[model samples]
Target: MDDASDDLPGVMRVVRGHLTETYADLIDVGDLDRRPPQVRDLSFLSRALAAQAVRILTECSAPEAAAAVTDGEGDHGIDAIAVSPNGSDIWFVQAKWSDRGRAVLGEDGALKLVAGLRRLANRHYDGVNVKINRQLTRIDEALSSPRCTVHLVAALAGGGEVTFQAEQRLTRVGQEFGFDGRTPVKVHTLGLADFHTFARLHAAPGPVQITATLTQGWHTVHTPYLAFAGSVPAGEAAAWFEAHGPHLLAPALRNTRSDRIDQAIVEQLVEEPENFWYYSNGVTLMCDSVQAQFFGRRLQGEPARLELGNARLINGARTLAAVAHAVAQHPATAEQALVPLRVICVDNAPEGFLSQLSAMPQSDSHTDLLDQVAADPQQLRIREEFAAELGKQYVFKRGAPPPAPSAGCTVQEAALALACAHRDVSLSAHTSAGLEHLFRPSPAGAYNRLFGQTPPGRQIWAVVQAHRLVQNALADIARTESPWRREVMDHGDLLISHLAFQSIGLEDIEDWVHSAQQDPDWAKQWTGDIVRSLAAAVTDRYGQSVFLASVFTDASKCRVLAEIVSRASATGNQESTANTVAPARRRRNSISVLVDHGRIPDGTRLIYRPGSPPEEAAIGDWLHENPRRYLATWVNDRQRPLIWEADQQAYSPTGLIMHIWREAGWGEAPVAVQGPARWFLPGEGTLADLAGELVRAAALDGGA
Candidate 1:
């Protein structure tokens, strides 16, 4: 056995030399197969071939020897460990030889291999742990100090369910018991097809010819000539090469056969005569003087135009080559900013190729607006003022009147006086200045009497009067020949047309009254002609059209329309005040609904209602009317009390009973519920029912 192994290297060298001489362009001669013993048996022959081929290409070395090992169960199993040349690393290789006389491994086999390795790594044997423990300890120490790597090699002989099974098992092991410190343990696999390629390139001619006999009664060797390339008769070899050579060679030359090939050819032409006459098929095509001059001009940074005839083989390649050559020869200058240029050709390119070209790096040289602004101080100040209110601060001397006395004494004094005046009469220095620009002053005493410090009742009444005045002014503006007036007129026409079709008269006095009550401006714009239209619609439909009148009368329904018209009117100084109303009373005696989707912890109080307002009585009445569908509280083993309150009072009740529910296995998982049912308040069910039902619904919807 030692003598045979010693001659293996010499045999491989001879085989590699023959292959290199025969297929110089195709094969890398430096790479040659080195067979592993565990895979030497006829049953594991393909594995041996694949292991050797991969080892050669990757410059990897096989282990010194292989042996069989068992867990003291009397099981005869081979443990082929391939150690790296450095002896510091090792790969536990396992081959699952098929019993069905097929070349490929099986899924069960792969799973068994993964399981066996995992057991080996963890098990302790023979008064001391096996090398696996020592390996793992070294790995752990290496990880703490630096990085460590481990490899798992799964060698498969043929194709079958084994391939898929092996991949899945490897993935599972990697995920579950990650490498040394949970670091990745690399896994490499060699399949049957790869093995055949290796065997054809490295096996001795005589032995290779006997491959079919060796694999007999096992895998059915199809086309042995094609399998080992030259192991069969000459006639068979010719036929196999003619049929399958292209298929085998395509992937290897895919990168070279790219669309840029034409471009590469053209670029080569731009070089000297010595470079242009390069050989591919041992045929050198010389460039004529004209072609040479054209390429010369292109190389010299001068634009050269070529008009190759309609032969696509020559023209397409020439165009692409020319473009690529030009780009390569003449690069962009720093001062002359580079802009990406993409040429989209619908010719024969794949989809999105043009888009990919367009995405290449390019320069966008444009002046920055902020940088320009930074060059000027006056512009910066103006920008700052536009961003915030303009104001100045100044210190007043003890004996002197405030600085800028005319502007207003001190800033604080001026601010305080303005605030006080605004509170007392709803007007401040700002308001006074704004008003002065719009209105002439009345006699001083007359103005003082109307807006001076006065009783609270009088002040309130005056403010209401002023508000009404502002509303009336805005109403006048709505009646003017302005853009807003025209828009209202248009919408009004649309409204009248709609009502007329429904036999509702816009001219009806009741309709006018309703419009006036809701919006004074619309009422003012309802002319006699519009009114007549309304009247006709009303008479035609009788009292059935009364609903149309009510639609226009409702204030809430017209709030949005009112706001639009108010904002459009030039004199609408009180537009902001038009919709302002007293805040609603905080409702008490209210039912809190809490639905914890397990995102919140148990006993987490998400909703708290401190006190109940008078409005809550209404809510309570509503809840009382619907009891069967609603549950107030629910508790489970995983969740705390759903609802609780402090104390109760009439006007300001404290501590109202809160409705709560705990729906286990709710939302995401590890479910718990605590809080009111605020999330499900709109539903008909009570807090407890909502929580339980929602969880059940989710689970059922998921087909749980």
Candidate 2:
């Protein structure tokens, strides 16, 4: 005997042939063989089972001719194109085939198929733009049109995995590519089982045999018999009837005494036997009895009372208590009960029970009776009253009697009264709002309003001082013909010279003079003092604003201050000072300072001055104490003093500043003091250490 797996193809072939023949009226010519083998099989089966779909489209609405299969490339991966009979719209079909057994398609495989379709679609469109035209032009242009509808059909030899991911991917792809516009692309999988049912419905013998081997040993066999009066074959009809026909007659047949319904109900009850009784009694009464009698210990009259085999009333109380306890422990089960309650109360009796219970008075005479009993002179007074009402012979009954309410007794009324009390005890809206008001901040709106405006005067003053320094620096550069000055001036020249000089005939020389005067020594000095004052104030106020200290105490800030001081010192002798020449002794001393301090590496010499040590310690100290001033003074002096000698070459003040600043902090000690001289050449410690100690002292003194 051939294996069942081997027989699948034969069975599929028969199903395919039967479907093609049965759906010939609906199938487009030449489409039967055009599809892939698996797809063809699916189309065959889908047509057979989708007879209602065909009737909905064709017979009812008079659909246009069947869509034509087209070999085209488009953004939506449409393999075939079709138009409604009236030319109202167009439809595109993407057919996929797989040999995997009848399992839902996996996410990865579905994604891959979607990707393939996307690639085909991308090739058809020139760009992002989509065009619509009815004319049958080149395949790409036809496919690229926006009016087309794309449908995805997965034809699996058996059902491939139809996962949630696959479904979502199909939906998303259809939306992105405008498959069916607002309607969405229709995605479905067709399997062999479907084909067998379809074949049976449309073209099979009167009786069909379905055989499978059970793992336990015996072979299970099913032979469905059917009577068909239509063009569909008996076998096909039998298969269809087996799968779908039962549902149509199920309701009527289920009402009768049928073994199928009985067996189904038995199986269902076995799975959830509690549901049998739960639904039998009205669900609301069952629920309330559980809450009141079982869990709550406040019994209300039973909504459902059934006669037991022993002729006693089996109230919902015990069951309700048990179910209520179970539900309380497992909240998930509690929520699931709401649906069943709505279903079981189909006649509206539960609603009536709720209404009746809700209408009861909150308090009655029983409350007054209880109060009276509580106020009795003797403890046994209430007991005596109760004993007088009962007969002596009935005192010790086999089963305990149900507890009775005092005086104007009504359990439902009491429960309703308790519920009302609970409602009244809940928090009031005013109390909740008041609690929120307590923790809020004072003047909350003030801070937000302040934040929306400009900063206060002190901050603006600091910014203006910084702007002045930048202006001075630019002005100084404009006055000098040095390469550094030239570079700095070029940017301004480009902007100003373009319109002011060339077109407006403004004199560049006059412009430079006016700009230079605005950046006078007085203005620069004022700005520097203002900035220093602001920085000091901030440091005192905030205490630990290190970022502010770094910016304000920088060498550039010091240099600006130093320039103003130097200019002040040189005022009266302005012309004479400018022409004054430093003696050979001073020059020689300066060179010696550079060498001895190791500003020039060992054995390095300067040609300008080759003798005497230049009060190296004093010069270095002054440089450290007022770096910006020293830099401004050095630049203003015409004597070009070589600062460092490396490779027999002299470095300028600007070059030295760049190198020193790269290694140290703003407003820090001179390079000569902090460099390798003191520590490397037999001193107790380095100049760097001294500088650090001095800075620390200044900081402690609140001077920095």
Q: What RMSD value applies to candidate 2?
A: 34.4
- Largest lDDT belongs to which candidate? 2
Q: What is the clash count for each candidate, in the order shown?
A: 29, 29
**CA displacement after TM-score superposition, residue 512 of candidate 2 (Å):** 58
Cα lDDT tens digits for candidate 2, 383-436: 342345321111111133533332221222212221111111111111111111
Error of 1 at 326 (Å): 27
Native-vs-model 2 lDDT?
A: 0.31
What is the TM-score of candidate 2?
A: 0.21
Model 1: lDDT equals 0.30
